[model samples]
Target: MCKLYQFVPIFCISLSVVCAKECSIVVLEDSNEFIKIADCSRRGLSQVPQTLPRDITVLNLRRNNFQIISNFSFKRYRFLQKVTLSENKLQKIEDQAFFGLSRLNNLNMSDNTLDLLTVYTPEMFLPIENLTVLDIQRNIQEHNNDVYRYPDVAFGVFKKIVYLALDLAPIPELGQGFQNLQNLKSLIFDRCFLKFLRGDTFENFTSNLEELRLTRCLHYFLHVDDNALSPFPKIAKINFEGSCMHLKQALSMLSSYSGKTLDIINLRGLNCPRFNSDEYPFVLTVTKDMMRYLKTVCVETLDLSDNGIVDFEENSLLSFDRPECIKHLYFKGNRFAFTKGRQIDELNTFFNKSIALKTFDYSFIPVRYWLEENAVHHNEQNYHSSNNIIYLPRSLEKLILSNLLCNDIRRHFMNRRGSNLTYLDVSYSYSNNVVIFESNASFTTETLVLDGHFHAALYQIEIVNFIHVKTLLWRSANLLYAMYPLDNMFYKRFITWFRKLKKLEHLDMSSNLLWILPDDLFLELDRLSELRLSKNLFQSVPTQIIFCSTIKTLDLRNNLLSTVDYATRVWADLMSTNHGFSLYIEGNAFECKCDNLNFIKWIQETKVDLDSRSYKCTLLNGTVITVLEAYETMHDLFSNCRNSIWLTVSSTLLGTSIIGVVLLIIYSKRWNIAVFFYRKFRKMVEKNMVKVTLMMFSFHMAGTAYLGLHNV
Candidate 1:
């Protein structure tokens, strides 16, 4: 009996080894010693893979053809912490399918055919005591008339689940099944057909809930009871984007958290009612009722973009008495035009109230009224005393003013109280002249972006005043010699200032029609890390100006460069040193020939990061192809072309040589050959004449003899 038992044990051990090898299960590298991972995903699996490693912590069987999960399917995998059965044909899971996976923390069964939770009783999840995340999203049938009904005791066993995603699932109500999830922190209900949010909707998750996302709930409406959202004491983020809700309802829901600290409140793209008519001169304003609710929430960042707000009354923001607490405000993609009349006062009042405002984004706001007629003639005194003064808050730091039309920027920065500005962007503005900074300007912004065409002569003097700037962007300024005759002075002054900018770290001069750069222009920029010289007229990379070791991002796109002599050396050096860098040579006109064979090879073999997909090279026949594709077929193409050229040259030379030999022989014996042919022709003509004369003489004698015989 003892010998039989030993043989049985040995047979089982060998069978397990054979199963492990036959199943093609892969052990993941770089895993914990005690917890290994086995990946058997997309192996045409119809059932649970058995005989796996005993200590496997994670098993992935995603995108398989498994139909059902019977009881004790994962009983042997007691140490599993994660299992993914997503994108499968799973229809049902028995009561004890995951009975022994005690350490399972994450379970993903999304995009399956599981419609009903009747079989998934509380006992099914009793063994997974530490499961923190459960995703059963998008598992319901779309066209069925029967809705997925959650049992009253479905999730009662998962006491430690912290995050749950029920996206695209049809649940009629939050029943007693949710009361068991006492440790849930974040819950997502995206497109879940949720209609009303009552005060007791989140009653079960009151103590531990922190983040709630209710995005794209098309038919949703907030029904705030007196104690709505009062259970969530630690709620930090509430994303209600793309939901169909009234502005007042959204505001009232936020008012529930008046005394609590909320970090982010995103109400983007809400269906707010327009205050004015939708006619030719349309005007939409934010009413006081909306602002009343806005003032209730104490949030750090507020995004009100894409809300179709055209105007704000002078007292629109008076209800938000706590504007000092808000820091970052975004009002992009709105029709908030700031004219020279009452709107200026409204803007000043708004800024003066928001005391602690730091970053303000007012981009894409068209300026309908500019003091152009007055600005051209006004002196310093008149300009300062005019009604065009735009008062900025003292706490303002970063400002974006792109796509605005204003003639003078000095009014915004003239004698302002705050000099702590760090970033300023005035790109794509309609101002014909640059924003000139006089000597009296006190601000020293760190980053300045001026990406638009301007009067080049005006910028020549204005650029010298930004001595303390670290990052500068001057794209598409039309500073070519043809456009601006004073380019010489601008270049000289620019070089002078460039040498003094010791702290400059980023410089972008794209689309500036730059043909040549001074050799030591960028030598003094020791801290420069990113340089953009794209959309220019440079035939080759300037090694002297771009060989700094600290540089990491070099954008030379859309240029007149045809070769990479210096660029190759620089990239090779950077690669050898193991420095991180990205080279963008996409739009250059690279030559495709034997002369560039070495460069093409380097492009293929170098370890430097390059966007070779868009990097094009022009072939000898003017055919353009991607550098990567050309690299594979360049040798054959060149060989064929070389052979064709040699063949044509040989054929032409042979034909010319044959013709030349024939002409030379004819020219050497020209007289002799001509005389011999002439003599032969004369002898043939003499023989013909003699034969004719003999015949005529014989005829005449015969005639005389016949005449004498007739006379006798």
Candidate 2:
């Protein structure tokens, strides 16, 4: 029956192969009359495969060895609307290379050896005149002189192009190369070197422009004229990531978008110039005067991560007229001067003014605790000691405070109006002297992350008050017996706290080195759908996880499990009958022997989703093979075990028969053996009596003979 079942999968695979296209390239998507995507990337092919269907609409030919794009190379695929020829050795493009691809809208030819001035010509782009998006970034620029100019005639025909990404060859101003892109709405310049921008830099390319990205454009110094971006008034999104600019230049750029509402503004890693570092390190303070520059701008998301912002002035956000319009603020990796009581006061004042702020990321900031000279004591022992409470904005939904050095978290962000956050992350932010949940604190966040902390602090806290939380991540919390003095006391407390979260749907306790869990640990988590226990010390599948029938995913990767025993396999099969449960047991050391023969059979027969390709099992002869290979040759691998079972049963019966025959012979001669012992005893007594009578007669005759001799 098992052999019959194996043929079902093989037959299904054959049918699938017959239905697919017969080509070397992989077909990703197919429609009724056309293959939507055909990927031939990284195949090491010298030329494009001609066996592909002619109705292919998308072709990916990246990382190939094609040196020249021959004319009409893609003429067969006339319906192709997008083509990727990046990371190739294309030094030349034939005049009519894209001859029949008039409907092509996107072309990516980045990371090639195509010289801009030589390979780009009017005839090269004449065929695909309707191309809307062109990405030719990171290509070779063969500029022999300082006065070399881009071949504008080739790009002048892309009148319908909306997006263009290319390397900006050191030019003083935005030349007429992009003037012909009248319908352009977005532009990306990589490896840019614009030290200064004049008022008329983007002269003719300003009307329809709305987004610009100047990535990796590092320079010693940068200067933007006040009116440099004045022509483009409708620009909404600007990304200057990895740009080395002083704080003043960044502020000047932000000031330019004073009255406009920007959708995204990314200035990550905005730092000072390399030269004159001793004079100006670019440490900034967001003071009231700086806030005045952004009073009117309503930015939806502002990312100033990795900027050295040290201080904030009092009432700084009050200087902004539309402070409530800012929704997201990211200040990761900033060293704030929060050691003083007055700094906390100023931060609260700033938060109070931004009533509409929805998300804030204050991760990786260093903090310390201090008490006021005359502090007021509260009844609940909340960390805030002063008379005033530091409340966050009521509208805040997400907050990330990971990896901070604060001693107490309750001292900050205690909203009086009862905050209801959607997500909160406080991972790795606990100090050695950090106090646990000793107050009557209640949280309503749906997702909470508390990784890398001791559970002893929260042992006696009111965990039932966390009513709305659904996802909890407490990874690497060191839930081991050796770390605590009592046996299983800490595990009990950990289970107690988790059981209170009745609404939790996902839990991750990976990297905790847990070998065992109480049988009732997951008994109350009725809503748990996914549980991660990877990177631990479990030697077998934890049977404690059988309590939750709602679990759909159980991650046991990178553990000490040797094999899935018959009992575990049976339980898993039964559990997966109702829900589609997936078990991730990769990176485990599995053994291949008769002891695990049933497990190997279950791997092939069970409906549970076990990632089979990654299963590596060790054989009895010290050889390693995959589980699938062991299943294919199981009769040979377990032949000795089958023979040994028969030998053991036959030897036991033969030994028992020999003992039974010896006992029967001894019982049949019991009366005769007893009579022979009685006769031998009677003859020994008669012989001793005859010897005593003869000795008495000899003594009497000697006495009579002595008397007769005396008379004579």
Candidate 3:
């Protein structure tokens, strides 16, 4: 048996050696059996590895310093599907570099120094007949003016390429190379220095192309030929973002997509000099002619944001033949003067055109100067026009009108057409009465924001109308002092209306100059989970906060609180019930003395989440430290103060006791002491007489003795 097993081992050793030699390179198995991946990227390799696995389907060689891709480099890996050689110093790729890789679908050579397609020979892409995605973006040097030429036969070889990214790779002209790519669906030419788009520039790709991006092209002007994209029946997206397109070119581009079902059209930051008028010198106005082109395209979402649009010409939107096709319109960060009556009327008319619009965002549209000068005129005109009502589209569900300077916003809500509106943001607006729902009107809106200074009347109206709102933000509104001293009447009025907001869950009243909160101010908000009251004048945690059993986030930052007793109690109560709540009590002026020693200790040992790193304390010597750091060094100081206080009290008590004992002894022995002193005094006088006689005799003797001595 031993002899037979030893003879079988010889045959197995020879087979292992043969298999190792055939598949010597590193390989990573993919989930799919047909695809094997290998990564030799950034290995400082000068040439392709020689013995790569034959079944490798994807190879990544990025960030290497290889100079050339030699012929038959991937001949063994005939099943390769993708190869990425980006960010390399590759200068040349041989004509048959990808020889026998007929199954390859993707080839990326971006960010390299290669000029593989400059000559446009058929052999450039001869090996990869099935390539679908070819990315050669950013391959040439900055000073190189040699554009990539596409010969007619080269396109036939790369006909299967559906996605092509040629960013920063200039092309001399739209030759028959593009016409031969019948299967191409996406074409990107970002930063390609394309100064013009002729009428038939994309005529060959009109039937199969779906996405076209020309971002940041044509620094001076983009001259789009008429009906340039008219044949693109299936095109879904066209992006010209950051392109300085002339007004005529823009109109012609839009005209090409007339009556086509486009999903998105992003013309952000489009520079149109023709629409700039003297009245609005720097900004472009959406004129009737522009609207005429926009209405022709059947688009779902149109992003015209950051386009320097100041205002819409009167009845400009009315010119739209089919405005219902657009669902969302974004005009944020534009400078619009919608303060005059005519301007407001024009805006209202514009909304009336887009009856199917679901969202309209006009936030940050500055109207301060216009409102300051024409507010009264707008009011008078509104009073006479259609009963002071402004209409909105019936299909609008979300509206944002933030940072507008209109003083009276009641007209915006009067006779509002949409009952399905769910989100409304009017923050940073100077409005008097913003919400004016009819008495019989009911709304389905869940979020409402009025986070700006407003009139008292508007606050009152908002409190009543937004009773069903779940998220309400009225921050920095000076609501705390709208009625001086926050009198009982004001509290009653506020509570009366506030208690009706039973659905409120998120409330932000931060940056309001509130010194104290009423005990029952938030009792009725049973569903509140987040309360933001930061940047106020509060010196202590409001005891009424304990009633918020459902609160998970309490923000009391940047206040004047000096102690944490109430805060500790609040944290304890919340934690004892297992109701997790994050406390933001940083930026408070906490004292760092023995008086607050317990508070400092509590903060250090608190189990609840707190922003304690910024919880600073002011010491007696004016030294500020974080609460935890102060706690580490303050225990001895507190103990020393306690000992000193005890020592002073004990000394005072001992002195008092000694004085009381002396007084008691004197009072109890008062008669006895007086009789004893009287007898003693008599004895003392008798003794004094006797002593005085003896002393006189002694003095006489001494004088006689002295006289005798002197006579002698």
Most TM-score-accurate candidate: 2
For candidate 3, the C-alpha RMSD (Å) to the true structure equals: 15.2
What's the residue-level lDDT of 85 in candidate 3?
90
For candidate 3, the 10 contiguous residues with the lowest summed lDDT are 1-10
Model 3 regions more than 4 Å off:
1-251, 271-281, 310-315, 333-355, 367-383, 406-412, 416-418, 431-435, 456-463, 488-493, 566-579, 590-607, 610-620, 627-712
How far residue 549's Cα lies from its native spot in candidate 3, in Å, is: 0.7
Residue 90 miss distance in model 2 (angstroms):
5.1
Residues 1-712 of candidate 2: C-alpha lDDT, one tens digit per residue: 0111110111212321232222233344333543467776776655555566687788888887768887887889889999999999888899988999998999999989887767888898989989999999878444222534667778888999999888655454345766889888888877566566556767757466888887765643556666666667788888877766655466666666787788888877777535336433667666676566566788888787767777677756335566677889888887664433666676676678888888988888765543444232333375445523456777888888788765433354564335656787778875322222325444767887878865633552533356577998878877665234445556556656667888999989899888877667788788999999999999998887875778888899999898976667766787789878888999898998878888888888888988664488998898999888889998988799788878888899898899888878767876776777777777777777777777777778888899899998
- Span of 10 residues, lowest total lDDT, candidate 1: 1-10
Candidate 3 — number of clashing residue pairs? Answer: 0
Model 1 pairs whose backbones collide = none
TM-score of each candidate? 0.67, 0.77, 0.60
**Per-model C-alpha lDDT, please?**
0.70, 0.72, 0.71
The 10-residue segment with the lowest total lDDT in model 2:
1-10
Over 381-482, each residue of candidate 3 has an lDDT whose tens digit, in order, gives 435544445576768888887776545434545435345678888788654324455555567678888777645435455445657889988888887765
Clashes of each: 0, 0, 0
- RMSD of every candidate to native, in Å, equals 16.2, 10.2, 15.2
User: Local error of candidate 1 at 589, Å?
Assistant: 4.9
